[model samples]
Target: MSDAEKTVPESADAAAPESAPERQAPRTLTVRVHRCGPGGANARFDDFRLPVRPEDSVLDVLDRIRVETDPTLVYRHSCHHSSCGTCAMRINGRERLACITRMLALGTDVVTLEPLRALPLLGDLMVDMRPMFAHIGDDWGYVRPVEKASTGVPHGVARYTRLENCIECGACMSACPVSSGTDDMPPPEARRGGHEAPAQAAPGADVADAPQERMFMGPAPLAALNRELARHPEQREALLHIGKGPQGEKHCRRHLACSRACPSGVYPAKDIMDIRMMHGGGKD
Candidate 1:
């Protein structure tokens, strides 16, 4: 072929690859939600079937269902990026933040969602978060001195502070068997050593008549206490008193469920263990 013909300009689009195949239709998901009314009256399970894209999160599905399927289906959510922790729930029997939990990655056709236990359940998936916050207490500081060397403090600033990692999602509380009193955990006397068992209730007396005791203060609060202690050594004595109280780190039972359920990387179990070591509890 002549040089001119041989060198005929290549098509402008010749280098481009073939267009991608058509995207598949979204998959349908069966979301089974645990429902309850005020004071847990008329509790039931409601199933919602909807089409979901692979990237769709559990919160997204719930939003679609609420708008198109049922407006009355109630749940709490804010800041869908998982920072708010408002959408935390039991996803397929594990504590997870719905905002970040993708529907397709669950590897199941059906997704079961339930509210965090041990908190006062309101209608539908909503629960009273007040109790969880109460446990964390009012004095626990949310911000800490920034430690990264790359992010230097601005001039005239004594130090920089950033919000702590714990979002107070209550996932730790839900996952903690001791805090929720689920999983048929043995009594304190049975779990602890060198402690005398209390007198048992009379056989004939009504069980309801007996005074109920408070369980552990839970991983979130204990973790917060630890953080506070780390930030303020002057408060060590006061904070340690709380940590070593009746509802303290000693009752953790070392399940480590809180660490697994935490999406914020707080590692509450490790903090509890640290508190134990600090107090000479010796890692029981």
Candidate 2:
């Protein structure tokens, strides 16, 4: 009613902090899935629009598509929990377990899904783990099992619980520059992950003998690290030598991608550092 009152109201509105506009949440999210024909051939992409649900996981949307839209769709998931290491794939350019990867947290309206790189692609989002597993050899050579009673963590052995632990998810390998173009790559049947290599490469490794340059066995070696630490004292030195040898730590590019992509917090880079520090590496 008064000019002074009107001016005061206008000044208050001008001085107030503009509440940062709340972002409008999407009602539906777009999922662009890399579809593979049987045996993971003829790779292609298909888009699916699904209703966004509260705390929706990437796996949740995929399950909905499989159950309601197309029964032919295939993917792998043993325990929907992160423990199984079954539902890992390239989601939005990062290798992560679908079960635990929240769709909303990605902060993107559209999410892209594809099989992990570096392993033989089986189909859709599935890759072969058998080839990778075969390298371990039959004698895991951990602590030899006793017929009578088995023991837990060995005394005086520093637990990898902090520095290095592996769940065999292969996500680290997927992100590693050293895990590609193996000189003696196992046959497809032996491996079932995507053949597409990651974008990065080790220094001087992008050219000829790309596979040969990779010294360590890549991120999967952490699993073997777990086992070796459990082996008898006599066997420990040999294992440490392998880590410091060619096809081991000497090839690491220090990219840090594998360590970052890991969902299990394995700290593979730290593991490499620990081995190098312990062995005082030298000429092979």
Candidate 3:
């Protein structure tokens, strides 16, 4: 072979520039779930360690755990999106839609999961939403008329309509102070002189003589009632009657927790307050 015609292979170090970048290591996370069997049996916390990406949501973690680590892990999810609201649960002690809550964004190495409160526990990370629906009577319609001019409706259509804001996820009911109990409730005296006490207190009633056991229909139902009234003004008399009842808007302490917990921007607390105003409950 002539010196000029000699064949040579490229060295590994010389070819390193053309090589693909090294793959980054996946992040490790600990998922802590509040588990319970049917009828609330074997209640305990189950921690699952898994490698996950930053974009993975809490629902994704749960799916991986159930598929790979534990097939017996029970939970509810549908649509894999926030529209269904079926995957709503308490994430890190706050009400959230698991399908949309990114685990890494929570800024915690360990993610805590629990079923919503004030509803019957169906199992791990699942609650019975029937009670909330029962309060929100079936008479109310879910769709409401929207202005056709802005919606660009077809010429044949009479009007455009849209779904009501409430997704009925029961997050409001879970966060409601009234629905949960009065154990953590602040005294009437402590609650006075703030936005918390919107309704007027009776004369000479500075402190609660006794912890009044008020029966509340809850924030979700009252918000639904407000929507019902807006859709059908003819039903005002009947709906207002319901709002003024013992288990209606009158019982709400105006904690406003429901407004903060709602993922769909329903602002249930404001709805309850509006009903109270319609009932002649003066503004604070």
Candidate 4:
């Protein structure tokens, strides 16, 4: 062969750089989204397989399912970055906020998304949080006009200032046995059926209209109560009023799941203990 042809063989290594190994496309994940139409109609688990990026969150997958896969898949979320806990749901049986929960971190090929337990499932992953805060009256939910707001944490005092850390994500409420929806969880043998709302509207009672008095006061409200109790020690009698009620602290079995379910570390279970102690209902 000619010199040019011979040079071609030698030039190959110098002329061409090795191509990078082709980046594999993100693997598809099976998103098992529980679906319940408006008013809890046609409830069921609709599984959709979609390519998931490593950084994609559970909320991201749900959004994708809504936009790209199923338009009717209903769910609720707010401040999709974790500031608002509106996106809290059951992921792989644990209560968590969908926005911050990374899909890959789930460690399973199929990620199950269920509504937070212990609440009325409005639709799909959406549960009525209204009842969670029902016990905390408007005045109780907020710090009333203070002669002086806390300047800062007093020296050497472990004040319960992390109250603000509670985004009221409802995870604690979902985990609580007394949260009203815990009993509705389908047995493992039963498997997926459709939408299982914990407290189905009674014959004459509307789920929305059900009396808060009859509802089990969830940890969310108790956490709010803790804030009020911390600020106003004189309201001990008012706190006792709730403690003795049928749906009040008396209903809690001390499951302690509330603290585990809390994404922000609010640990409403501990707050419950404190409230009970002050009311003379809990032990020392």
Candidate 5:
């Protein structure tokens, strides 16, 4: 053999560095997205395989699945960041902001995305927030603003400030089991109408406009009421009157799931505990 032909082809490793084992292709993430489309049977999970990078967000994977893979995958999302909370959903059995949940944090090749449980599913991953926020209003809703603007800082300013953090995203509602399934539960809109329902009945009446007055209130609105009650001690008696009955604090099962699912850390479980204290005559 010639000198060039006898060179042994550089031993394959010395010439090309062994090709680096094909670099593994960055891993494709498989997401099982629960979908409930119009006239669909019950709810079903649609599997989507997406190639994901380490820095990709859950929302990114979902979007890719929607656009590139399955156009039928339905979900709600506005801000790609965590500011909107519109993309909040249950990822891997935990409520999270899809925009902020990095793919690497899940530590799994398969990520399951579902709507916040309990609330009515609007479509694929969208759950109705109206009922959840309405749950709060059912328990005395908002302060009546005693005197337009009293106490130098405004009468209901402190109460409003604290409750304003609520994004009304239904994270707390999704976590609450009582309000989601049980009948005879009053939604928050029953207390404060026009925004959610626009035709809810008066606070104490079983008005024909809204039948939700008899249903149990969920955690989100109750949490807001708890914040309001924390501000105005005098409102406790009235709040208790509104918060009583099957639709009130009695519905909560002490699950503490509201606290766990809250993307903003509002702590609906703690709020419900405070409501219980007030109901028990701790303060008002």
Candidate 6:
């Protein structure tokens, strides 16, 4: 008990599970995922054993493996919840929100995760969304605006709240057949050219007819079209003009897969219907 003689308690590690070491060992979960390297070659399934818990989602497993075991195991994820659409990936052959897709719901102990197909894959489980967002802009649609009268009271304010819940997970685009194969399409970039780039119509060049490319409108714009149309009780005809041309409302195939896979339930198919009704009629 003397001040100088008193000793601090031994560290927990010094008196640990020497008698039952196996009980402290972490449990391993089987992870089978598709992988692609720098070039498109060497595509194959890569397996890894990860320490995981029953309540963990597929995203959680991928994150744990990437951080604790292997840094090269690449994937996109943000918000951890469904708020940010960064973590959308395929689980067990279906498009789903990896952050919410529970490990137990993944069926077999051997879980499989993959990137959204048809889009450009940056690495394992990461695809370029530039193409997807570009299609959204090309559709020339905007979120339908509520009138001033509707904003006066609480009842009107909440009218469009449900549609705003979309996280843009891109599961819709992954399910679309057109986005997978069309090569002439331009991926969505925020702007056409850099600030310093010369204007094509300044002098000798006839930039008016600069070969407007025929691009396939992807799901984000189609989803936006749906969101806008859902509230556009009056502007249906005008809004239909947004997606009217070759790459507009004419592209949707009425698959309804977009709505089925939307993690937040934005109905791109129904939106396409509204556009069709405004323009003329549905395709036969």
Q: Quick one: best TM-score, which candidate?
A: 1
Write down the TM-score for model 2.
0.67
Q: How many clashes does the backbone of model 5 have?
A: 15
Q: Residue by residue across 222-280, what tens digits does model 6's lDDT show?
A: 66765665565475555555555455655555556677888886777777666665543
- Higher-TM-score candidate of 3 and 6: 3
Q: Model 1, stretches more than 4 Å misplaced?
A: 1-24, 151-158, 185-213, 280-284
Task: Specify the poorest-scoring 10-residue window by lDDT in model 5.
Answer: 191-200
Which candidate, 2 or 4, would have the higher TM-score against the true structure? 4
Which residue runs of candidate 4 sit more than 4 Å off their true CA positions? 1-25, 141-163, 181-215, 280-284
lDDT, candidate 4, equals 0.71
In terms of lDDT, the best-performing candidate is: 1
Write down the TM-score of every candidate: 0.81, 0.67, 0.78, 0.71, 0.65, 0.67
Model 2: residues >4 Å from true position, as ranges?
1-26, 38-40, 137-165, 180-216, 230-232, 280-284
Angstrom error of the Cα, residue 172, model 4: value is 1.4
Alpha-carbon lDDT, every model: 0.79, 0.68, 0.77, 0.71, 0.67, 0.65
Give the clash count for model 6: 2
lDDT score, candidate 1, position 12: 68
Better of 2 and 3 by TM-score: 3
Q: Which run of 10 residues does model 2 get worst, by summed lDDT?
A: 190-199
In the order shown, the candidates' Cα RMSDs to the true structure are 9.4, 14.0, 11.0, 12.2, 13.6, 12.6
Better of 1 and 6 by lDDT: 1
Model 6 spans > 4 angstroms off: 1-28, 138-163, 181-212, 229-239, 280-284
